[model samples]
Target chain A: MEEIIKRAYLESLDGRRFGDKKEEVEKIREKILSAKKIVVATNNQKKFNIIKDIISKICNATITMIDIDTRFADLTRVPALNKGLMALDTETADLVIARGRLGVPGSGSMLVILDGKGRILTASLSPSSIVHRENIEDRIKKEIIEALSRIGINLEKY
Target chain B: MEEIIKRAYLESLDGRRFGDKKEEVEKIREKILSAKKIVVATNNQKKFNIIKDIISKICNATITMIDIDTRFADLTRVPALNKGLMALDTETADLVIARGRLGVPGSGSMLVILDGKGRILTASLSPSSIVHRENIEDRIKKEIIEALSRIGINLEKY
Candidate 1:
């Protein structure tokens, strides 16, 4: 029997791999054992700014950004306008993230997350339809908790 | 001297060209002329619903949609997805309408228009971005406009 291989996309701004060599992930994993803060990467000014703004008020962490093509080319020949794939692909991020907009009476986008290795840790494709709606911060926090659990990262201290 | 031959993508929904077989574009042109409202198609269901809700307050044609695949398969490939193409050719579309999102901000999608006999009329890639936030809608509108103009269709009515 053959094992199925899957590649997960991480969000980063430094480069496609989020400035981490394979050795770096090992060191970071050790820090997670007792560290108060976690460092993660995302793509673009718009995306980084959005994530940083939200995460700052929750738990504290240094949100470093890197430049990379979060868009997965292998999924299809065409590139996805959505940024979730990019955020999840290259970084040492405990979780990848994205944000969408709100419009009309019942139209809006969602914030999605992927794990460090390019797997979709958790996702919200279509969230509530309100511009800058309340509880968005809380919702994201909850999703992060669930995603980390799936990846076997415990956030009990923070 | 031989004239430069251009190419394009023609789109239809559920295999129905917008107009009659003898004069394919006339049906769509007529619809536009009689339409009091127009709603652009998008993958966002919320947006679609909102647009539909507001149609009565807006234009008169009511809301009609066409699905686009930014990843719409290349005509030469197996398992063709082009509705217009099938009507004209076991080979190609009058104009290839792009369906999915293009990754680049201002790079847009493509359209290949064909004559009645499946001859290539004109082919053009749409602008990837709109003047507003560079998203999928802007790209599709830009491509549709260019494709229509090349075919000598008046767009102000649309």
Candidate 2:
């Protein structure tokens, strides 16, 4: 069952398989793991606090919490604003992460991870079951850890 | 040039021609025009103040502002939370209008109008040229009036 799910996930990539290139993934992962700074974009303070607590425990990287509502208030295009914001901070951060609604009925939340160059490295989806519930700190932590692992980032050492 | 731009804009609608049905558009327009209470969703206080001031002068609708940041801070999915919020205030508001980033690079802001049932009645996009600048109160008001006019809501009577 796990293999089937894994295969299905990989097939869903539709030819964009950065994960298939182990060496390249490793290089990017190394750069991310050794980074001095990272930014997480979220409007929810509770989610920010939980993510900050977990990430701080796992790595020594400086994590900045950017409230999407406040930070991008004046900007209309969030993804464009995101790229612009990252471009301004390219000298400081190795990675930037953002999450928001998928905007489709019955669809869930989406997480986007980008490099300093504003290139999307990977994305993950969490269904309504996970996002709509209360007390989801553990689920979010586990999901983040798994997503990082899929991108060749092993948090065991950190 | 103006005629060409209008032609191009109509062409851009393609198959979705809600504006073609005069009766249907008129019905929605009447409902909106007669609405006693309306809610504008935005986090920017300055934008809210400008919208409120303009709307007050144009109609007798009791306008209320819902700060998206404070309102949806606990929820991860904005659209879902929006529906829920509107559902809770169905008795208070006749229409709920939400504005946000369109997620397309170089594109402008999008305004979504939803009924009590959370069904979108109409959507409009304001180009980045108008939305990105500072002190755009008059422009915002003009754009909103134009958007409503396209949906068959003429505020000339008000």
Candidate 3:
């Protein structure tokens, strides 16, 4: 069977297999795990602050915000905007996280993970809508952890 | 006290009062009450279809879609975009509805209501995240009614 799109995206972010170049493989993973600067770009100042808190809850890093787009216009494109910025030599950070309305029929937001070099590394298309029995933040936290794990950046190791 | 922002926006859309030109005022209200065309604009093909269903569930009107813009980028801005189109003489419909991530610290989407001329009318912030014992669709239906009622469009009159 073929690997899912999320795995493929993560692999593209950091293409290193278990059997190849033990030292270099560990080096890339170590840099990602120990990344200290996180960049968040969105026009929603309130969400930018909330996302900053969400990131702090999982890892120790400073979040740099870029609020350069029109409100409501930039809801879902923050990830791609940062990706473009990174490629354009503007946003050079350890990691970038963007969240907005998922396209599918649901009542939840979609979170996208991008590496320092502006490569997307996750498959979070349809995170379940907030269920009554659980905290949505917790569910999203787990989703983030799982996404990072797939891309060779395990949060538990820290 | 002065009207809140939502009411004010709606007022700007249709500025007619009970004291002047009673027949003309009633004529416009009747037009709105009997609106047959609903326009929904969003880049999400899946959501475009889902919104079509939602509109059908509310009223006996057909939906026209305008899907232009990058994905994830136009989530919240759909309302304003349609408003712009209306101003630019592009979209000339009876009603416009857009839903996306609310710009606040919550796990819910924001639904904005606009008239044929792209005038907004409604104050629907803080719709509770889906609850355990309640069906969210029913709740939102009620909310939609309340919003319409505030702008003097009684859904129950149908």
Candidate 4:
């Protein structure tokens, strides 16, 4: 059975841009592989659909998405609460996908993976925010692919 | 100019049921009349759209709905952050309408009004809950009508 990895990411206002891209996804992918349970702290279907597609390719994990009012409910907003909520609900914690702010142009993402108990596991940054003309979706795809490749996560089929 | 009155309500997870029939809607309507801005926290388009119809009869102020994360961003888990995010964003802050949590068999609702700067002008509790067996649409309309009647807001055409 694919392990569950609960994590959260900040979706850009335009529905694009994630975070500091330096080796982030790769590190998160590694954690996702080893985790037994995964939950995402977001209710946005659009965000979930996007994350679901990206994670499935990198690691085979049973992921559940829960929508929390990240915008105004938590201290660091909804994204930060993702880890804490998962730690409380799941049998055991695995990894948390943490992304930095996604407001800069062509800015890569910072993906941090935390343990099931909300401890930092490993981190990888995928730097891909150089191109200005590229669309946000394309940029995100490029960065995710790079991160996965760097961490030896196979996403060729995806 | 039609003063746009944003009606806020809480939807119980169970369904719609309320103990007092007319009194509930009446209360919510009063809140609407005294309000200058409204905020609905849920990202459900259906709910927001339904609200859009109800408020139209009350007043003609500008109505803006707050966006919530669908699958990954659940408001229940992070109510504070969700509220905060709405407050931080300039657009969301303009008109804040938040739903309250009233647990029962029927859906629950509350109405909140904010000023131009997102200040809390007034707040009102909705009448129906998850325990109410009446049709939600009818309940909503009836509640609005009752509320308006109390505040001396007449909507004969609606």
Candidate 5:
């Protein structure tokens, strides 16, 4: 699966070059395959579509894609209580649980989803940035449930 | 911007319900807005296309979308020296620098790209999970440059 995607990335790069085209593609491939979880940071719908669609047609590991960046960055969100948010998104920790620490100073916890491998994924600091602990957990849970349902993953339905 | 995207997620819901549609949409919206950084976790290319294309037409905050999930989870990657990768991706830190601390335990430093508020974006561990420091940064840089080039941002050309 990783290999196929690497090829897709390599394929996406034309002969066009500023430095060394081959070197560039190889470099990109290295980065692409590194993620424990896949969280794409893209803003262009057309381009994203083209790359995924083209690469997907070939055989590879198939997964889900969602639009988290409706207004802000709905790419893939990695929520944390506070500190672990980074640890989680970066593939350092399988899970991260932080509390009372962030821009809001005293925020809550957060989480994101992943299927396999290191769980390359997304991250975000809940709007509850200012919200205290205890209360934030329920909020994050509700939000995750909500996100899952949007994409047809209704646990209740199941 | 958060409001706009919340609506987009809500609008995408279409009142379809196995449970409470309104509640479901609202929950989804809350989750969507929480991310400190925007890393969308999605797999369906077509659905992603429609959401972004339609929503983009409306406009709140425009972003760059790429094929991070080309193979595995190319959605986006958060590279770290050792730790703090999550900190970077989840908007905790504008930057994180780690060394010989990831799955590769002895792996080197890592970094991701971000702009504005928090870096709502993507993340992944390096394939060099076993590789040491010094070597990984150059490799990561090359890969990033390759990625940037693919999107038509050729620094060398510039």
Candidate 6:
């Protein structure tokens, strides 16, 4: 898992410069394949449910949703608790996936995956045009699969 | 401004335990007052506009909206670029205010203000109920003033 995450980080760095969504997704998919336990961190239950549902359908990994504020209520007062530190403190998960408000109305969201050490493995801003489509669930699912395929994860087998 | 940010950071550590909205706002208000130049960082243009509008109404500080991806397109490929490092690299601003997707369907937003050093001075998860009100613009304006007042800022003068 660590090796996969390191490779993902390296690939993500290369992909981000060119804004290559395919490469970014491919790297993340590789990390996801090696991850046995994952935590989806967010304050909104709705977003959590959607993400949890989607991940479950594609992988056999153990998934959990953590309410950011609830889990870090104590740290909220800690002045040094930046996003990375907050994420790093989640010791239970090999991978931490966090969702935040994109400030855009109707679709489009930022998906960031962090390793146990709080290193950002991959981040992507989902295009609103596609996210705002009628079948958002299906679209998201398809995107996830396509991205994962680059890393050799066949959703059909899962 | 450094002193104000320090004081706000200290106060934030105290108020986070109880989730005190007023205290959180007050600390941010102080931070804002001391900030000469501020950068509002986010990928979504709509979110940037709203935040820019709100901050402009309350203070005379120089504000700029930075599209996170545009500025860090090259760094995005860098594996070491965590959220803190990303905010820190914006050398133009004494302070960087960032907005993330809250995963909520509408209204509610998470606001985080980080000092030049990337220390989160203050953070707030605005309540959705208040955010989703009919007159959102007016409500946001009012809320900004009210929160600032806790820190002794008379928005009426600004």
Candidates' chain A TM-scores: 0.38, 0.64, 0.51, 0.50, 0.32, 0.53
Instruction: State the fnat of model 5.
Output: 0.02
Instruction: List each candidate's DockQ score.
Output: 0.04, 0.05, 0.11, 0.11, 0.04, 0.04
List, residue by residue over B7-36, the lDDT tens digit for candidate 4.
122323234544434544454455555555
| Interface CA RMSD, all predictions | 10.2, 9.1, 8.5, 5.4, 15.3, 15.0
Worst 10-residue lDDT window for candidate 6 chain B reads B100-109
What is the number of backbone collisions in each predicted candidate, taken in the order shown? 51, 0, 4, 106, 73, 8
lDDT (Cα, tens digit) per residue for candidate 6, span B40-151: 6655566567767867876577877764563332323221123334655855777776643222111133345566666544333333332233454454445444434423
- Write candidate 5's Cα lDDT for B1-158 as tens digits: 35533543354355321111233233333332332323222233543443344323323333223333322211233323112333334433222222111121112222232223342222222333222223543555454443233222344543
* Preferred candidate (DockQ higher): 1 or 3: 3
- Which number leads on TM-score? 2
Q: Would you list the C-alpha lDDT of every candidate in the order shown?
A: 0.40, 0.58, 0.53, 0.49, 0.30, 0.48
Of candidate 1 chain B, the 10-residue stretch with the lowest lDDT total is: B1-10
Q: What are the per-residue Cα lDDT tens digits for candidate 2 across A1-158?
A: 23433654676656554445555566656656665777777656776676677667656788877643533322222332343343334335777766654443346555566677666666666676655584466656666776677786667866
Interface RMSD of 1: 10.2
Q: Model 3, B49-73: lDDT tens per residue?
A: 6556555655678777665552333
Worst 10-residue lDDT window, candidate 4 chain A: A1-10
Q: How high is each candidate's TM-score?
A: 0.31, 0.42, 0.35, 0.35, 0.26, 0.40
Better of 2 and 4 by lDDT: 2
How much DockQ does model 5 earn? Answer: 0.04
Give Cα distance to truth, residue A4, candidate 5, Å. Answer: 5.5
lDDT for A73 in candidate 2 is 20
CAPRI classification of candidate 4: incorrect
Please write out the lDDT profile of model 5 over residues A71-130, one tens digit for every residue. Answer: 221112322221233333443322222221112111122233322344322222233322
Over A48-121, each residue of candidate 1 has an lDDT whose tens digit, in order, gives: 65456644544456566656544322122212213444444334565445544322224444444444554433
Q: Which ten residues in a row have the lowest lDDT in candidate 3 chain A?
A: A70-79
DockQ, 0 to 1 scale, candidate 1 = 0.04
